[model samples]
Structures are given as C-alpha cells and as structure tokens.
Target chain A: MAPPTTPTLAPPDAPPPSTDLADAEPDTGRKRGLTGYLLLLPAAVWLALFFVVPFYSLAATSLYDPSGSDFRGYEMTYAFGNYVDAVQEYWTPLLRALAYGAAATLICLVLGYVLAYAIAFRAGRWKNLMLVLVIAPFFTSFLLRTLSWKLILADDGYVVDTLQFLHLLGDDGRLLATPVAVVAGLAYNFLPFMVLPLYASIDKIDPRLIEASSDLYAHPAVGFLKVTWPLSLPGVVSGTLLTFIPAAGDYINAQLLGSPNQRVIGSVIQSQFTDAGDYPSAAALSMVLMVLIVALVLVYVRRAGTEELL
Target chain B: MSAARPAARGTRPPAGRWLREHLVLVLGLLVLLYTFVPIAVVVLMSFNEGTRNVYAFQSFTLDNWANVCEDQSMCDALWVSIRIGVLATLGATLLGTLAAFALVRHDFRGRSASNLLIFLPMAAPEIVLGSSLLALFVAAGFSGQLGFWTILIAHVMFCLSFVVVTVRSRLAGMDDSLEQAAMDLYATPAQTFWRVTLPLVFPGILGAALLSFSLSFDDFIVTNLNAGTELTFPMYVWGASQRGVPMQVNVIGTVMFVLSIAVVLVGELGSRRRSRALSR
Candidate 1:
C-alpha cells in the first residue's frame, strides 16, 4: 500500500559517497572496531527483545492448551497432538489457501513474466515509463487497490459487462466472490513482484547470446527454448516463489473479495486468536503453515535449482 | 496493447519470424492489462459521480471525498495508522541501520545466525509472522486487546529486515580506509563516524527509513494481528469491504498513495543530486 513492494531492487538513491572508507581506513590498532559494535547494539537489543523473544514464546505456546477457566496461561500438558487436531480443524482453509496461491502464482507467472520480458528486452526505451505503470497500483493502499476489484467484479460492474459481451460468461455476471476473482486479485496485486525480478534477470541476459543460439542452426523457437528460458529460469524461480508464498498465506482477498467460507489458514488463525480465543489451536495452525511453507521452499530449492537466485 | 505492439515490435520480418520475435511481447502486453485492469477499474470508478456501478456515468461528484472527510471514524483510523507508520519507521530504521552495519562490516561470531534471524520475519508469510508476534505479545501477559504499543512493535518487526537489506547493500562498498584515515587524524571514533562515515551512508539510511515508514503505514497483516482496538487505514478499508466500500476509502487511498510517492520522490531526488555532485 505504502512502500512499493519491490524487494531485492536497488533503492532509488545513488550509491553512497564514502566508497573509499575501507581503502582509506586500515584497521589500525589505535582505532577501535568496537565502535561499530556499539552502533549495532541498540538494534540488536530491539530485535532480541521484540523479535526473538516473541518467536520463542510462540513456539512454546503451540505446545500447550487451556489449563482451566482462567485461560490466562498455558495448561501444563505439552501436547503434540495439538498440531494434528489443529490441522484437522482447519484443513479446508489450508487447502483453499494453497489452491488460491497456486492459481495466483500461475496467473502472475503468465502475466508478470511476460510483462517483465517485454519491458526489459522489447520495450527498451519505454522500460522506465512502463515500469512506472506496473508499479503504480502498489503506490496506492493495497486495500484500495483490492477494493477496486470489488467494484470491477461487482455483479453490475464493467468486468461482468465486458466479459458477458465477449461471451465468456452467461448473460448474468457472477465473477465477484468466486475463487477466480480471489486468484485474479492476488495475481494482479503481486504481478510486479514476478515482473521486477524477472526484468532484472532478463535484462542481465545478453541478446548476443540469443543470436548465438540462432546462429548455430537453431530454430528461432528452439533458440528461445534452449537459451532464453534456461538463462531466465532463475528469475522465474525467484518471481514464482515470491508470488506463491505470499498468495498462499493471504487472507485479505479471501475475506474481502471472496466468501468467508473460503477462508484461508490466515483467517482461520486470525479467528483463533481474536474471535475464537483459542491460542493453542491458533499456534498449532501457525506451526502447520510454517512447516508446509518451509517444506515447499526446501523442495523447490532442492528440485528446481532455486539456490542459483540466492 | 495492440496500439503499442504493431508500432514498436513490427520490424517487418517473414510472418513466422515476426510472430516468433513478438510472441512474448504481444502476450506480455495482454497480461499486463489483465494485471492492471482491476486497480484501473477502481481508480476510474472512484471518479464516478453515481452511487451504483453501471456502464453509464450518471454524474461526477466530489461526494466521496467529502464523505471521507466528514466521517470521524475513518479520520481517526487514518491518523492512527499514520502515527504508527511514522513511529514504526523511526524505530525500525534506527535498529535496522545498526544491524545492517554489524552484518556487513563485522566478523562476529554467529554472523550467519544473525543474518538469518534478521531476515526471518521477511521470509515467512505475513500472517504466520504476525500471529507469531501476537502470541508473543499475549504471552507477555497482555490479553484481550493490545494498544498502540502492540501495533507499533509489530510494524517495527515487519519493517526491520527491509531496513537492514536496503542499508546493507549500500554499506557493501564502504571502504574501511576512510575511517582509518579519520582515526589516524586523531579524531575520536564517534566524531569520525558522524562527520565521515555517517554522511556517506545517510542517503541509504534515509531511503531505508522512508521505505520502512511507507511499508509500515501500508501494513495490514501484522497490524491486524496485534492491533487490538486500534484501527489503521487498511483495517478500516478492510472492514468497509463487507459493506460496499464508501468512496471515502478511495479518497483516502488516493491521498495516501500520492503522499507516499512524494516521499519516495524526495528520497530519490536527494540521492540523484548527491550522485550528480559526486560524479561531477
């Protein structure tokens, strides 16, 4: 909403002026290095207190259930079954999240990668202007942007009207609140994520390499398939992973754009802590999400060569 | 899209070659439109004077913008979010700078561990991370609802890694020699840092700070988890969605969006000027 969500990109600021600090300042015994450590202390303390402590507490909370009516602290029982019961309690939400995430990733890959490629390679002079457009939506509040989908997909909105005209739907328009709408929302919001990284990767790719492929008696399509795709695979991995991970956990679209019944684990977790007042179950649910995401990340890294991007 | 494609990519080749070269280009434009249309629809719809959605514009009015200002709750929530964003940015930037310095310059024990920990919040899904923080806050003996402190703390946690990343990348090129030279001149370490090293990294720090503020202001997930009774802009807009969103939400969103862009522009412009000076 506020920060343009392009992670891994360079900050617009030019490089710093103190480039020669290392070369100029040899580590003299007279000069103290602990000064840097002192500079680091405040942030370290903040992270330790706010970040590290809470995570450990969360991990601990996942193991316990309500002891009595007080519900103030953990019940003495360290039950691992909480995870199983939690998973069973919320399987539908979890599956729906995964499905929505998958659909969104697919759409983003289709649109975002293509856009990135075009802007990076084909739309050379227009790259910055086009990128500004691609990133423009993000400049607005995410909620506002998502709410736009509500307007567009409203039963009486232009989207339905346009689609109906194209005969993509029946006379009645019913795009809003559908799984498709949720997925489309996710893809639209996160597409710049896919596109930006891919643009960086593709832009780094030399056109001469593609020409070389064609020069070697290769079909144009073959050149693209063999040279371009493989070289750009790192971007694909980065972009897809970036899109898929967030889309999977997103409860916002499902809540606002889609039906409540289609709740993801995020919404489920939100209810557990806020509405349901079930900390143990919420903790259990969170652990499952963390595990699944980590496992998937690991598998993707192992199988799909994601480490290359890293 | 068709408007741009034929004009731009049509270096007329054989039909097969033309299609081959432009396939990604054509498909890419269509995809970008598909991605862009939803937000575009909203921005356009905000301009509609009519209440209901329809093909025809009944009239154009400033009623929504007027309504947004009139509503006290939205104003309160927007202010609360802004306060939190500013506070979150300040808190995160201070820590993030230190952390970034440590990660980049030091050969400390557990550096990798520190690095991974620094990035953990960013790496995970926002919900999970938010929930984890909420649980932590709850465990600290706060229950029912967390106040501003909870929201601010959560925002800081979320934005810290970003601050670190932005600052760290800039710090990568810092030559230790300049600091050594300053120390050799009998300047105290703090003086050398403030006058020499600090000025050099100030842009990165400011950029990181502005970036962090914008991100914190826009945050929904972590804030939702920890924000007990306190409502932020995103929280308000989200709640509004259940009932058809008022045009005020659009008004506020457009305003906030423009403001954040302005902030980024300032940061960028400042840096560009610095770069131009250095290059000269």
Candidate 2:
C-alpha cells in the first residue's frame, strides 16, 4: 500500500519494511563516510530527544508520590511502590489485555497463515493483487473499522439475529459489548501484520522442497509439518510480534466493541492520563506494561529461534 | 461436480485429499471476507438514513454523503487531523529520508544504535510512546500547551521511525551501479545525485510520506494524551462513538478507503505500464 516513488512509474511489489527484510542488510561501515554522520544528525538528534528522553521522563513521572495531583505539581519521591500500586489497582485490565492480545494473535496466525500461504503459492499471477487486498482495510481509520463492528454485532444486527435464531445465542445474548467482539476486531485489524511476514517467508520457500518431501513417500501433512512449518518460523515469529504488540496496546476495540468490563490496560492508562489526570499512576502503568511486553518479547524471540526483531 | 481422476493409474481421489488441497485457500478467502465485512458495513452505512443515534443500519439514503459537514465539530476535527497529517508527513519524510540514505549508502559509527532507536519507536506500544511523550511535555512545563504543537511533535516522533524504516528498505534494495554509471559519464556528483539518485529514491520517500500521513491522520491514542482539548478526526470519532457515531463518520471512512485504493491501483497500473514499456 506504499506510494510509488516516481509519478510516472509504479512502485515495486515489495511489502513495507514492517514485513520481511528484517535481517536483509548488515552495516558494512563502508562508502561516503563523512557525509553519513551529517545526514544522520537531524534524525539521530530528534529520536534521542523525543524518543529516548521521553522514557527517562516517563520513568521519573512514574516515581512521583501517590499524593501528587495534576494541579499541585508532582514531586519525584522515587516512589517505586507506584509500580506495585499500578498492578494492584489495574491488574484485571492488565491481564485481560495480555490475554486478549494472545488470543487475537493466535486467531490471526491461523487465518493469516492460510491467506499468506495461498497468496505465496497458489496465487500465481494474482499474488500482487491479493497482497494489495490484504492491506486495503488498513488504510481506513481503525476507529471507523471498529465502529463498523459495533454496528454489525449490535443486538438487532444480522449476525446477532442469526445466532439467536440458530439457538447459538440466548434471546437476549449479543455479540456487541462482548469479549468476543473485541477479539474479533483485534484479529481483523492486525491480520495484515501476520499475512505479510508469512507471505514473505512462505513465498521464498522452494516448491521443489515440498515436492521432494512428497516424492520421498511422506504424507502431505507430514511434509508440511516437517518442511513448510519449520521454514516459515521466522515469518511466524515476526508476524506474531507485530500483531501481538499492537493488539495488546490497542484500546479502541475494547472501548468501542466491548463493554466497560472489557477495558484493557490501554483504556485504563488512557483514562488515567486524559480523564483522571493521574499522571503518576498512568505513568507507572505505562512503565509496567512496557517492561512486561519487552520481557515477553525477549523470551518469545529467543524461543522462536529468530533474533531479527531489532 | 468432480473432475476426472487418473482412472487407469490411480484409485478415486480421497475426499480428504481434495479438502486438504483447497482448505487453506478456502479458509484464506473466508478470512479476507471477514476483514471486508466491516468495510462493507462502513460503505453501506454511509448510505444509511438512520435518524436515531444508535448502531443500526436503518433505511438507505445518500444524505450522509451530501451533508457530511452538517456536523461542524466533525468537520473541524477532520481539518485538525488533515493539518497534522500533512505537516507530520513533510517533516518526517525530509528527516527520515536523510537518515535512511545515511544508513543505507554510507558508513557510520553507532549505526546499530540508530537502527535500534528507529525500530524501538515502532516496537513500543502506542500507549507507552504516548504516555512517555506526554510525560515529557508535562515535565517540561508544557502541560497547558499540549495541543497542536505537542500533537504534531508526537506524530512526527512516531512517524519518523516508520519513515526511516520504509525509505531505508527502498534505499538498501536499490542498485548503486546506476549512480556509479552516471558518474562514469563524467557527470558532477551533484548533477548525478539530482538526476539519477533522487528519482530512484523518490518513490520510497513518497511512500514513506503517504504512510506517515495515514498514521498521523488515523492516530488517536497518542493524540488523545497529548492533544489536550483539540480533537482530531479519530478523536472525534471516538468521542462521538459513545453516543453512536454519526453517519458522516462512515462517509469519511468510505471516502478514505476509496481514495487510498484508487491511489494504489493507479500506481500499480502505472508501474505495470512502465515495466511493459521497459521490456519493449
């Protein structure tokens, strides 16, 4: 979905950098030497100031005394206990965010793998067209997309009415304002994240390898399990990370699609910062969430046998 | 409905084999359908004539599209989002393209560190990035000043990373021999760069700019924290959503989808024509 470079020429069909090529290039420390640092200076400075320094500020803000208010300026009492307080106060949402994100990532995996596999292998000349379709929805406002789900899964909506008629749902049961709705939104929104990486890895696999495995008298399923799955591990690793991280932090789905009871940590942190004006607790919650995600990602990448996440 | 199997060489194809062969593709289409359902709803709802402020598609009409700006607040919010998006895109594309060029075409110390910094913004959740930036602004005594400038800062900050990553990939994938060949013709470095390098790299830069705009436009989380009282389009949608969003929002949504798809398709077709011409 990226724009073409030249006005007269179309961009190549390479997916955005969010997908493949994570480990494509290494720094050779070669060529136009002096100008490199000059060119890099503006961005490097910008990131260090805005991106890096904000972390320091956030950590400091998180340590402010619990008694602090937005009106009466905060004091950094080094109240590391704020972290403990954050968990104690909002653990349900915290845990719910992680759980929902995990569930959505898994669903995205199953669906995205099939789509990616199909596009990579079965699409032939239509591969590029299908890839465009994968990212088409992403261009729309995410909030609008979630809002549509709110419409579709409403009490009187077709999906809900059908389910009720089929006896799959009770008379008063509804899909809107439910955890299922939230997870479904997450899965839909992040599906492209999963599909792109899977396509990248699966597309690179040699068709001959699968044929060779089949010729060796292995069953198709066995061939897939032994050869295809293992080869696609890197994409799986990257795709899951891309999907899970954003899904975990997303509040829009939980906010618009699910009820108040489905409030994830993102919602809590948002309200604390914007509505409650409780910067310290919010900062503390943000820190905890960041640390937890980082720790989880480290363990996941290590286990997934791919450290290409940088 | 079944096709003829190799009757002489093999037994009848197992049902399981047929299912297995097409299962993934079928499931994939279903998933694609699932994704499109909401988009379809967005389009259909744009034509909805629901008088109530609830989430149901009542009768159909083009009133929403015709009178989209009847809600002044929504239009104002859209304006805010567009302004922020355009400014952020320009700033990010300029800075990011330079950084991308440096990383891909030149050697430098702390290259890995810069790359990590670029990647970290993307890897970090929006909540974390937003809250942290808000903290920075608040701490710097800009608590009251958190609106357009602050939102712009946050937008550019997040967008810079993606911009860098996008342009970096394009630059990295580029063949340097073209520039070398240009220089071999005794062309000056500046002329070769302007004539050869910029045209080649411009696509990636344009792509980065487009991405940055969409991201900035659609962003709500960071903007919510840093925007203070100013409402962008997404923020307006979020606020209005609680009371059942207006159909005009759906109009915007449908337009966005159509416009982006049109842009992508034109680019695709143009590239196809160019490649065909090149082959000829």
Candidate 3:
C-alpha cells in the first residue's frame, strides 16, 4: 500500500517556517550536524545489516552448486548454470505471474479510480468516514479474507450460479481453481493499494481547474482527460507499481483460489526452497523476479515522468 | 443536500437526473460493498455449525464463538502472533521514529541516498525479502534456529520503512515555531520537546504503531519462510485451509475485524474532536 502522507493541515496562523528554516544560515538554524547522524545511525545500520547484506547473501546463494544438498552442505561453485536451469524449468510460472499481475493491476486501476474520484469529489462531509470504510474490511486477516473468497466462488456458490444463470458462464463452469478467480482475488486484495494513492493525488486536484475547462467549452470527459488524468499521473504510476509488484510475487491467491495450472513464480520458489531443498534454484528465481520487477518499475516510472516518487 | 432542496420545495426531481448526478457516489459505494463481501462471509461463517463441508453454511450456531479455543493450536498461534507483533512494533517504531526525525528535522549528507534506501524495501516484493533473509540465515549457519527471533527481525525490517515514511511525513508537515516559542519563553530544549513537540507528533507515532502491529500480525509470506516450526495465526489458518478450516478460525477473524475497526474509529473520532477544539 502507498504510505498515507496526510496532506499538511498547516494552522491558519502558523507561518510556514519549515522552508524558511532551511534557507537560514546554519548558525541561525537548529543544531544539525552530529545529532542528525546519531539519530540515523541505528536505522541505517539495521537496514545495512538486515536489508542490504541479505541481497548479497541471496546473490551468493543463487550461485551455489545445485548438486549439493542442505544436509551435506553446498559448495560455492558460482554456478551461473543455476539461472539457466531455473529459467528453463520455471519460465512458465514466471511469465504467468507477470501476466496475472498485469491483468489484476489494470482491473484495480479502473475500479480504484472511480471509488477514489467519488470519495474525493462527491463524498462531501462523508469523506473521512468513507476512507475508513475503504480500509476497515481489510483489517481482517488477509488469509481469512482470501479463504472467504474460496467459499464464495466455490462450485456450489451463488457467484458462479449467478454467472451461469446470466448466460455468462457454461453450465459446468466453475470459478474456484481457475485463472479468473486468481486474477480477481489479486485485484480484490490489492484494490486498496490502488485507491489510497489515487485518492491522495485526486483529493489534491484543484476543483476550479475542472470548472475552468468546462467554462471554456470542454466536454466533461475532455476536461477530465486534459486536467485530472495528467495531474494524477504520479498516483497512477505508484499505485500500479505497488499493485503489480506484490501481485506478481503473490502465490496465495494462485494456491488457494487456483489449481496446479495457476501456480506462480512465488509458489515455485517456495516449493523449491522448502520441499525440494533446492536452495540455489529458489534463490536464482527470487533474484530474477526482483530484477524483472525493478527493471519494469524503472521504465514505467520514467515513462510516467514520476522519478520523484522514488 | 443541495440536490434535496428542490424536492423539499415540493417539486419532484426527475429520477434520471438524480441518478446521473449521483452516479459516481453510487458506483464508488458499490465498489466498497464489493470489498466487504468477503468480510461479510467471514462474519457469517463465524456462527456456522460444524459440517463436513466447511465451505458451505449448514446451520447457525454460536458454539464456534463460545469455544474459540477448542482448537488449542489456533490460540497458541494467536499468542505468538501478538507477541511478535508487539515486539516488532516497538523495535520498528523506536528506530523508525529516530530516523524520521533525523531525515525531516536536520540536514545531512547522503539524505537522498537514505531516502532511496527507505523506499527500496517497500518496493521489493515480500517473497524476495523473505528469500533474501532466508538465504542470509542459511549462510550465517542460523538455518537450524529459524524461529521467533528470526521472525521478529524480518518483521521489524519490513515495518521499519513504513514507520519512517509515516512519521517523516508528519514531522515534515509540522510547524516548528511552537518549539521556538517555547525556547523564547525560557523553557529548556527537553521541556519544549516533551511538552509541545512530542504531543503533536504522538498521533502519528500511534498511527504508525497500529499500522506496524497489523502488518506484523497479518504477515504470512515472510513468516512462513523464516518460521521453521513456530506457527503464527496466519500460518495456522493457511495450514487449516489445506485440510478443513475450523469454524473457530472465522471466530478469530471476526474478532480481529471488529477490534481493528473499533480502534480506527476511536482514533478518527479523537482526532476530529482535537481538531475541533484547536479551531476554537
């Protein structure tokens, strides 16, 4: 989820002194030199030790000799062949995860935009209440909520029956253990990630700009296209990245709501590590997924012109 | 209210006009309702009587709620989750608050680099984070001891970034003149900090703590990777799902939902009241 950066509600009387202090001379400003470093040292060290060092460990683990088992211990063979083997064996699930993630993210974007827009522009005095409602349902256990989806979309459930009755599904069509269920589950779980960022941006839009466009004879849709969409690009970029990253790596939906056919890269990696004890292959797969997501995010962020989001 | 004025004046508005005007709100609400469908299921299933087909409702009964601990393992897992959640929240909140203050209140070298560092963990997928940590643990020869401490470390690592972002935003948006005024009035630096600054920043800290607790408690992916034999609530649920989930699981789920919503509502109401008081 996007970090909820509450828009600054600067008191009416308080002059915005933050920037003024920044512009002031160091001598005239608050003491800054050693205290800042002192404060930062703990977290910086924590991140360095746990976060940064682990990446190096993962990289090293990815190169270990695949012939070795955990009990016998592995050799540091620097086996680049592990990557090749992983790709050769698991590429289907890898690509499937990415495709599912993309489909789910697109779905979330449309649904999220409408909900966010309504909350921002239409909810009036009910804005905060509606925002709370958006997150309230999500406060329940994620696994439990997802399990509910399994029951809701079961073979005998109303959703499938309704679809069949509406002539949208075949008489024997089932929802559980299907790609549609996996994607829908992904979209449902990650919708808040899309909505919150979008709401943050859309809520900041100056309503007068839309009115001004209308005053100049622009159609409502045209006004939205020219003003609202461009202004909300930052949120769109962040939301899509947030949604896509987790969705691609997620296996819970695929495992619970889907079948063997819907297994994703995450499930593959998990099974390889725990079940197969093939640490090298699992590490290689994880590294590949991370690299691919990072590459896609970079290109997407660049194209969207929201580098500041980083 | 504006749309209701003409109707109040004894003129019946066109049904189509009203629908068109409020279309976005209706659509938005429908989406919200859709999100809650699963929660509704969870709540409804909490009261369901025991049946062979756990997925379908059999009959309404309160036995599950009454005997939430019938499955002793589930309660044990819940306890582990709570302990880890509280410890992780404390560690993350302390380190993160300090870092947030450093980033927002003072100028420093490598500030941009630090910001990027904070952002990267959030951007990285949980699978990757979990795998990387597991790899590290294996490499360090602690693979045999993958349990509570390891889970706590992973939770704090992930939750740290979110805490920093939350507190940093609040600190950055804050006005510092109050502190300056306190100094002008001859109060000590610590006095001003404890009295004025801490009180204002406390809400953001509390919010971050709550966020961290929820994230830690509900985590499964990372915990499953590091927790060799220890079970968390989510892990227990995942395990149960493979066989047949006990109705008591739904009881716990309902309790979590109700409790969290209560907390959020209370916080929201308190903040609103505070703002109203401030305005006066």
Candidate 4:
C-alpha cells in the first residue's frame, strides 16, 4: 500500500539517492561546494520545524502526566510509572504485533523472492505486465484491500465453503476473525514491498554467475543458494524490516479482519487517546513503541549494513 | 482445462524454455487476478440493485451511485479532504526537500542525529506518531479543533519524511563532481544550485509532491485521531463503513484510484523524458 503519510515510492523500492545526484553533473563545468547546502535549506528548516519539534514534544509528554484521567490537558509527571503501566497493559498486544510482523516478513520474503525470481531472471518481455499486476492491488483504496479478506474469509465465504466441501471443516467452519486472516491481510498488504526491492536487487544479478557455477560442478539449486540468495540479502533485510515495523503496529488489518482478541497495540494506543481519553497512558504507550522500534531498527540496520530508511 | 494445461506443461520434465515461460506467464496472471479481484468485487457491488450484501447477485442499478453523491455532507467532507490534501502536499514538499538536502549534501554537526530524527516519523507506527503529535499539540495549548490548520500541520509533519526520503535518494545518487564543476565555473552556491542541482532533482521533487498529495488524500489513521470534529474524505468513509458505507464511496474510491494511477504514470513518464533529454 502507498504510505498513508507520504506515499513516496511506497517506502521500499524508492530508488537510492545516488541515482539523482549523478544526473546533475555537467561534463565540463565545475560544481558548487556550498550550493548544494544552500539549495537544501528549505527542506532542513521544514523538517526541523515540523518533524523534529513534534517528536521532541512526544518524548517530552512521555515524561508527563495529566492531573486526572479526565481531559485535564496534562500536568507534568516525571516518573517511569506511565511506561510501566503502558508496558503492563499492552505488552501482550505489542508481542502479538511483533510476532505478526515477523510472520508477515517471513511470508513476504519467501513469496516475494519467488515472485521476484520469476520476474528478474525468468520472465522476459512480459515482465512489465507482471509488475503492473503486482502493483494493481496497491492502486485501489486500502480499505477495500483489507475489505477483500472480509469477503474471502467471511463465515460462509468461498474459503470456508471450500473447506467444508473438501471435508476439511466442521460446523463452525469459520476462518474469519482468526489470526490467520489478520496475518494474511498484513502479508498481502505488504508483499509488494518485498517483491519490488527483491526485483531491483535480483534484477541486477549477472546471469554469467549462474552459468559460471553451472559450468563447474555446481547444480543450479546450489548456485542459487550460494550466490542469488546471499546477493539479495540486502533486499530481504530491508523488505523484512520495512514490512515488520508497520505490521507490528498496524491497527487496520486487525480491526477489519481479526477478532477482538487479535487487537494489536496500534488499536489499543488509538483507543487510549480517542475513546478512553487516557492521554498520559497513550503517551507512554507511544513512547514504548518508539523505543522498541528504534532498538529493533538499529539491530536490523546493523545486521543489514544499511540505514537508508527514510 | 486449457488454463490448467499451460501450468502443467510448465512444470513438466526437461521444461523446455517455452514451457517454462508459459508457466511464469500463467502464474503471474493468477497473482495479478488475485490482486485485482477485490477492487473488482467492490465495483461490482456498488452497482448491485438490491440493498442486501455485496455477495448476493442482483439486477444492476446506478441508483447507489446517485444516492451516495446526493448527500450534501459527503460533498463537504470530500471538499475538506481535497483542500487538506492540497495544503498538506504544498507544506510537506517545501519542507521535505530542505531536509533531504541537509541529509544528502551536508556533513555537519548533529547531521546523523538530524537524519535519525527525520526518519523516525516514517519508521514508527502511525498510531504512535499520531498520538504523540496530537498529544504534543494539546500539551502546547492547542484547542480541540480538527479543522484545516491542525490537519494540514499534522499531514505535513508526516508527509515531510517521504519528501525528504525521495529527495535524499536523488541527492545521494547525484555526483558531487557536478556541483564542484559548477563551482569551478565561478558560479555562486545559489546560482549553481538553481542552474544545476534543482534541474537535476526536479523529477524527484515533483514525484515527492504527488506522493505527498496521495498520502494526505488517503490517510485515515492520523487524520481520524487528530481530526477533532472535522471529517476528511477518508475519515468519513471509515466512519461510514462502521454502519455500512454508501455506494458513492465506491465511485469516489474509483475516481481517486484512476487519478493516482495517472499521477504515478505521469511522474514516471516525466522523469523518463528528462533523462532522455539530458542524454541527448
């Protein structure tokens, strides 16, 4: 799905920055040293004013407390209890979020790798059509994307109906409101993220390497395990991290497809602010998510050897 | 049976190149169909004549579309959303480009810190980001109004990250020699940037702009949280979904889909044209 906030190149397959800078070089004339700096000022100021400031406020509020549970606009509370409460209340959801995210990431990697393999090394001439189709679901309204699962996995829907017909069912034969649907929705929503990056990474792989391996004693499978998989690890790492982080916190898929028990931390945090009016607790929950995401992302980047995520 | 035949042939022994290609083509088509089916179903239901569920077949009618648009409130909400999207795009692009430049071009004090800060908004969960921003605003004496300004500010704050990322990618890929060569020609920093850097990264900037527009247009989670009493298009649709959404929502959704596709295609085409021109 296009990012709801910035929708810029869908976050995962955005062309790396080096591509654009190469375009600006004139063959003959000299380039300005400070000009790039000068040109970049507006963007810097904008980020500082809007982004840096708001987050500072978010962090600051984590250290605060409202006078009461009722909307009192917060009187600062400098303690860790809020964090404790947030953790205690929502840790299960958070863990569920992480597990779902990891599952989605793994599924995306396996499926996307296969899809990308077909497009990059296998398909020719028809490659663009395949890509267009891969991206087609993303072009529609996201609500509908999630809503499709409701149709497919609904109690008497095709999936359930088929299960019963195949004697793989019971009277209850319901797939709706299950973790399976929730995870599947998240996976479907993000599979393209995995595919696009792997496509780019795998597309650049040289066929000569495969032939060279085959020319030796290596089998095609062995050659892929050695070269193709390892070379595409960057794409895998980035795609997994990209899908996992959002899936961990996603509320929509859970809300639309899963049962009440399947509520992720995202929905809970949303409730604290909107329905419960529990601002302090919400702030603390937000902070916890922030800290966890930062920690996990740092570890992933360290492993992936890239921190180019926007 | 024929459709099945192609796939079976594909996996057959020795798998001649033709069979292999046929297998991929068939599988690719299936995947595409899987992706397209949902939207197609929704579109189909929009025209279903009966008031019952979408799954059940009925005679076709355009009445749902007519009823969906007949509401004055829906129009107002859509207008609000469009205005908000337009404003958010403008604000995000203006700021995002600068942040991208700082991230890409300069190696200054706290640069890494700044980069991390800008990136957090994108990486963090939308709920976390929205609640934090909403809380921060209220904590700073913000009143309860999900009116235009609040939504615009929030939209820009979130959207800036994309612009920054988009512009930064273009900037990173850019060769420093271009700027150095411009300096060698005796042009000032501002002039070189205007003549060289801006032109080169123009496609990225434009892409970022459209990206921001679509994002702001489609957003629900943040807008829903922050939209005090005001209703943007997505928010309205989500709320209506709770009680069963109208058919016009489908129409609006279709329209938005077409427009966004055009925008993406146009951005790609524009950049292609520029590159070809530059190469020539």
| Best-performing candidate as measured by DockQ | 3
* Model 2 alpha-carbon drift over 4 Å, by segment: A1-29, B1-20, B52-54
| Each candidate's interface RMSD | 8.2, 6.1, 5.9, 8.2
lDDT of 2 by residue, B151-211 (tens): 9989999999989988988887776667667767776777778999898887788879988
Residue B53 in model 4: lDDT? 38
DockQ (Cα-based) per candidate? Answer: 0.37, 0.50, 0.51, 0.30
Write down the TM-score of every candidate: 0.85, 0.92, 0.93, 0.84
Give candidate 3 regions above 4 Å deviation.
A1-31, B1-18, B51-53
Error of 3 at A45 (Å): 1.3
The Cα error of candidate 3 at residue A87, in Å, is 0.6
Residue pairs that clash (backbone atoms under 3 angstroms), model 3: none
Weakest 10 consecutive residues of candidate 2 chain B by summed lDDT: B1-10
Share of native C-alpha contacts between chains A and B (below 8 angstroms) recovered by candidate 1:
0.47
Estimate the overall C-alpha local distance difference test score of candidate 1: 0.74
**TM-score (0 to 1) of chain B for each candidate:** 0.81, 0.92, 0.93, 0.83
Better DockQ candidate (2, 3): 3
> Mind giving the per-residue lDDT tens digits that candidate 3 earns over A1-310?
1122222333422222222322323332334467777888999999998999999999999999999887889899999999999999989999999999999999999999999998988888789999999888778899988999999999989999999999899999998999999999999999999999999989999988986886687877899999999998888988899899999999999999999766899999998988888999999999999999999888988988877666
Give the residue spans of candidate 1 off by over 4 A.
Answer: A1-33, A66-73, A308-310, B1-36, B50-57, B173-200, B265-280
Of candidate 1 chain A, the 10-residue stretch with the lowest lDDT total is A1-10
- Contacts from the true interface found in each model, as a fraction, amount to 0.47, 0.68, 0.63, 0.39
Q: CAPRI band of model 4?
A: acceptable
TM-score of chain B of 1: 0.81
DockQ for model 1 equals 0.37
